[model samples]
Target: MASSNMNIPSGYVSSASSPDWLNKGDNAWQMTAATVVALQSVPGLVILYGSIVKKKWAVNSAFMALYAFAAVWLCWVTWAFNMSFGEKLLPFWGKAKPALGQKFLIRQAELPATAHYHKGGSVVETAMSEPFFPMATMVYFQCVFAAITLILLAGSLLGRMNIRAWMLFVPLWLTFSYTVGCFSVWGGGFLFQWGVIDFCGGYVIHLSSGVAGFTAAYWVGPRSSKDRERFPPNNVLMTLTGAGLLWIGWAGFNGGGPYAANVVSSMAVLNTNICAATSLLVWTCLDVIFFKKPSVIGAVQGMITGLVCITPGAGLVQGWASIVMGILSGSIPWYTMMVVHKRSALLQKVDDTLGVIHTHAVAGFLGAALTGLFAEPTLCNLFLPVTNSRGGFYGGVGGYQFVKQIVGALFIIGWNVVATTIICLVIRLFVPLRMPEEELTIGDDAVHGEEAYALWGDGEKYDITKHGWLSDETNHDNNKVPSGVTQMV
Candidate 1:
């Protein structure tokens, strides 16, 4: 524990004062974690989405991520946060209320009561998860998780969804879908009471986003035939840049879930990196062996799988266990994407722009189940408030705990499928789910009246006819064409 009297850095901290209930170290770390998590969506996914799509769809792809982040914030504070973590309204949800009111925001952060369970659905006692920080810190931290989940879902629906429908989808899904998972798993609802161990949101965020993204992709329809056949990233370097942010930003993600700057947090940070690095290597090795060449995109996919896989048990598993999860995450998702997806008729029908289903949904489920299998008893005791929670390998109640994880995952999958489908159907009544053919063909230029690139001279839009050296030069060399215009090669 950091001493209360620790020297404060000058000018960096706005005020020297802190309340008795607050630990300056915890509060500082919490706020820092929140900011980095926010980075994963803004510049992180934003850049990745923009650069990975075809040049024409770049702006629209990036805007979807940006819009979801902004819209979630408004919904989060107004009522979504409380619906996720406030007082219980049902076994799987919390009551909705504004989190911005000073009376709620200024108080010490409090977690909902989770009931302990033994084998066969027996409850031990209810435990409250109280953190030493102001309510505002908790709200900010949780909101980022909510925001990123929506942004990730946008990955599948990218390239073709109507923007107006997407704007409406975010708030409704946040309110109806995300909140239910948030409350049920982490907010001390029935799943928590039943001894499910999601150290972070393996099921809540990754699985939910992946499943929902795929569902939305089905309803919104595939990208244009041209795009589906040969869509190459407009900027691989920029995609790498965004992938790097998401990789590093995860330090704050797994570390901050403990809501403390403690031993578990340190272990989580180490395990997260270990799993990601190992998974990346495994994926690269497989690619080299089979394809005779390594792919940067494949490497990024491995990195993501590792991250999502470790999330559920980051603080609840040992270092060695993380490596096991990593190796499997890397291989399993790779096979699914490379082999299973190609062979399956169902998978062929849906055009998931970025393969989010493989990276997020499959890898997420793999991680969740592996967490149940390998969760260290000592570590689980440290991270989970439930007295005897442990993974399957630990024996006795451990096997039962693993089963609980599977059950929890099923609930999440079912809910997201129903919720996402309903949300899409509702939005379609007001607006078309798919963009018009003109907009689909023209991409960013048709939708936003802007293009991502201006390779033409003087920053003008490219015009094959007008800007062609032979076409215009022959006619316009008579002082009609611009002075510097040149012929196409």
Candidate 2:
């Protein structure tokens, strides 16, 4: 273990202050991971939503994601961060604290009791201790997770959701719902105390987001009739870019969970990529076999499910285990989306815009279960606290870990379903979630006063017509047409 003298001040551990290459390397990687995640939501998913929605609603969908990204950050730094990572608030939450000031940016962090820090070896080790990076790093890292959760939830309410209602919902849900999941599962709540290991955030982020999204969408209603029937992606290239970003961004998504750079982080990054590639390959193969051709879009969805599936065990499982998880995730989610969705009369009533229920919720739950089967003793040992033993199949451990995984999953799903439904109903009492029918038909133009694209004759010409305005060139050119000229007549 790395040495660190604890006699120094509360926030100044020597390992954190040392110039060790490993420490610096890990910090750099963590920052990079954060940046990648940020990109996934910004131009990546933003463009993806813009292109994938009906042309008229492209701007609105993209704006929803963009607004969530910004709004979550504000709430994150102000209070949400403390709620998730702060001292215990309850069995399922933590006390709300502010994350402002220059000290937060430059200081190292102490692992909350909820993080399960325990002393180990001569190093005076705690559960998962490392010299802290600047508080800015912690805040930024956690903020990405928070932001993505909101973006994922937005998927369910797309198309018909009023921009004003959505703008109001992002911070409210993050504070009331997301903080609880993050705190309980990862912030050292009862679940963590009971040894529910979520290496990344399968249950906390993906499953919770998926459930909340579907519920919110149900309350918000569906898109216009024309949109539901003939909505084609405006730009497949943009969608591909977003898919690629999500694929690479997951390295940070899973790897950064360790919160420090180490072999575990490397292992997680490698396993994450392995699972995603395998799942994408499997999905493409199935698509070709069944549809006579592989769809890039379908392959992207497979990749996403694979990533979500490996999130809970990225550092704890082997390469071969990841491949197994990948195959299952790809195939299972495909079946759920195709067969189950078609046959389920209940699901048919609510239009889940992007099928987040299949990709995030189902994949997340499956990954959590697989973690119970595949977590390795070696990785668990490296993670500290020693309390985290290997998975069920590993001789020394029993069914306990699997049971813990199930308990955690159920808790998260239940919390989200109840909290989200309540939040929506309460909000509905004052403000309608869906827009007026006329606004729904007119789309982003009627709502945000914006259009996503103008792909005709250099774009400027179309833009002028759509917004009902003429540029200087148009006015000058028309002036040359002569007063009251009737040339065509």
Candidate 3:
């Protein structure tokens, strides 16, 4: 019996299915977390984008997000995954390599660049993050994060970007922009080594997407003048459905950061919900007071901001601090979108369709900054490689930690801006970043040869004459469809 079992790993219980190094619970949880996060991209944001834009542009907007999710997966496994979590290539990047081999997949997951050593006068602290799960689990978990960032960026370019250009943009941006940010922040690049607190992805995913999305919107230009003036949600109820998924699915988004079903994950999940609820309430109150009526769209924005703000410190701060962060998240982003954006010429010039700059960029920066203030020392010890790390609120070396967080956010923002611009410019050399005038005017039907809804005239696409819709030909000589149909479109 002993001779027959010679090849089994040491401490192997009995069956090959149960390896000593593999913690089944942790592996299962990680996979489950990854799936929910993936859902946030596919059906979550996909539904949101599909229903939130002008009806004519629904199919194109959803397709952009769907295409990005699929494209990121392939690129992630082939090379981008390693460039994010493999050996260091530069201070802010990792070496590119394929992560598809079975030998590599079955091995225990370890972020080599995440190893750290600290010497405080007479004491030394050293640690490395080695999750008790196969590398496949880690790869899939990280891939979802990458995919969602690209999909989020699509929000800003929604009604007008060329599908062909966007298809190309996804893989290239994943390669040049997203990988660098992922490597630097979460994959143990310079920011991680410097002890910048990004407990989840305040800087990596939210901030990066917000900045890149805004920048891409600038390069791609605005939507049709008519659409921009009158764009309204095709279905607010469906938008809420997607928003609910995003809110619930975030349990896994932040929870999975620790790579285990442990205390930290539980804490993260709780904090996530607390912050989101607080922010939603605060946002609703503001809308009632300002507009004299609560706006569901505004409430969703608040929920998103709260979620983004808590992500960087979800497991590292107390629940009270989450409420504090939530209050600010609800207010600050609301002000930016409602007041500051209107006053700023630069903000007005960029047609960020979903206001990602306000919801993600501003909120993400606020969260990262707050994390530097509220991150508890004991909690930091549990997850951070840098020992003795604490937020500014805890005193001692906490001040330095806060500064590190801001610096980290700046690096991510600057990198995404430059990389996204370069990517857009490069793609423009081959294909137009914005669709031609006709496509912008016609929306999805012109771009994709399909429409999201066919409610008029024997299931045919919208038509003024065939559908017998009335129009004021004298008032708008060029207008084809009736005013009621225009609203529906």
Candidate 4:
């Protein structure tokens, strides 16, 4: 018989409803945190991408994010989640298996392969991560992280990627590229065992997305030449709204990393905001000095870099270190995006629609290295699996930790470059990597048969004469206009 005690307090309970392994507080916080992180993608990045791009690309840009979110959820539950956090299939890969059974969901959340042994022959064993929550909660939390990474990668290929190719690319890249990075950095692969500190997802999410997005952009080629030169945002205010959601949603993004509503989670939340605020101000100041005025877009870019920069050490570093990270994250990625990108031939040749490479990749790598330098020993003891792990500034074996960070970052970069390229190439064999030239000129209406805004001339759809669907006119949705409505001339 299953026990159904609903009012049980703290301490272990034998009831089926209140399992001994369950911590109600942690479970509640974990679910809440996961919900907010999911919000960062559905409405946060969706609005950001929709408004940041030129008017014509708004629908396509937003849809790419929306579609990826839904697709990743399905793929994650069916196979990708286990391949990321389940039984080890290889040093950097996990076995593919369904994670949808009631038996699997009710078990206590655990990272089976993350247990580490000490180098010395002391017979001491570090325990695996066993968060005091049901496996269902863990699955939900990790699924959001996986979904957001795919959406962030979509930022680079927006404004040009073929919808069909994007549809194909999302699941493929998530399986081949994302799972490997997630496993290696966070799921107890070589990097985790060797003491790489990705406090949240600096390497797995940001760095992998950054590198993969840029690589995919390169293969997909540039947007139409005309739009590239004069791509103005469709709605700056809405973009700011989206940015605000992202900014606040990160409270969960970093806070949930500890898998508990404990001191480490509290510290992580504070550090996340501090770094983001400092970076935003620094970026604005730089824009004023060089461009003669504050740029909203530049400030948003700064905020993103700061968030990425502190992610690798959010819980393991002191607050002061976060400000230092913020200063660098704001300026360095700014310089690369504003100055180096213009000078570098390869960068200019590849039109990364949202500069994801600079914001995510560069900042992620920077955060990883800085974490190697700044991770506090005491704080590390609270969160890290490896005992006595300290940053280089703390002396002892810290320098080796720094080297491990670099090696881990390099592995992610190398793997993404290879995996993303192969995925794009394989996608190309089936369909064009880019939309047709006619569709390119017409934007959303041509590709998705819709427009984001229908403000002109009686609110009718795009002028079919100029941007009609190329496949067949009869299939067009707008053709069946209301009886009394007037069509746009």
Candidate lDDT values, in order: 0.88, 0.80, 0.90, 0.91
User: Tens digits of per-residue lDDT for model 2 on 341-409?
Assistant: 989986877889888999999999999999998998889877635465788878655478888899889
Question: Model 1, residue 463: displacement in angstroms?
Answer: 3.7
Q: Rank the candidates by lDDT, best first.
A: 4, 3, 1, 2
Each candidate's clash count: 1, 6, 0, 0
* TM-score for predicted model 4 compared with the true structure: 0.93
Better of 1 and 4 by TM-score: 4
Quote the lDDT for 238 in model 2.
Answer: 84
Output the better candidate (1/3) by TM-score.
3
- Candidate 3, which segments miss by more than 4 Å at Cα? 1-14, 119-124, 461-479, 482-487
Q: Which wins on TM-score, candidate 2 or candidate 4? A: 4
Rank order (by TM-score, best first): 3, 4, 1, 2
Clashing pairs in 3: none
The residue-by-residue lDDT of candidate 3 on 107-147, one tens digit each, is: 88988877764532223355568999999999999999999
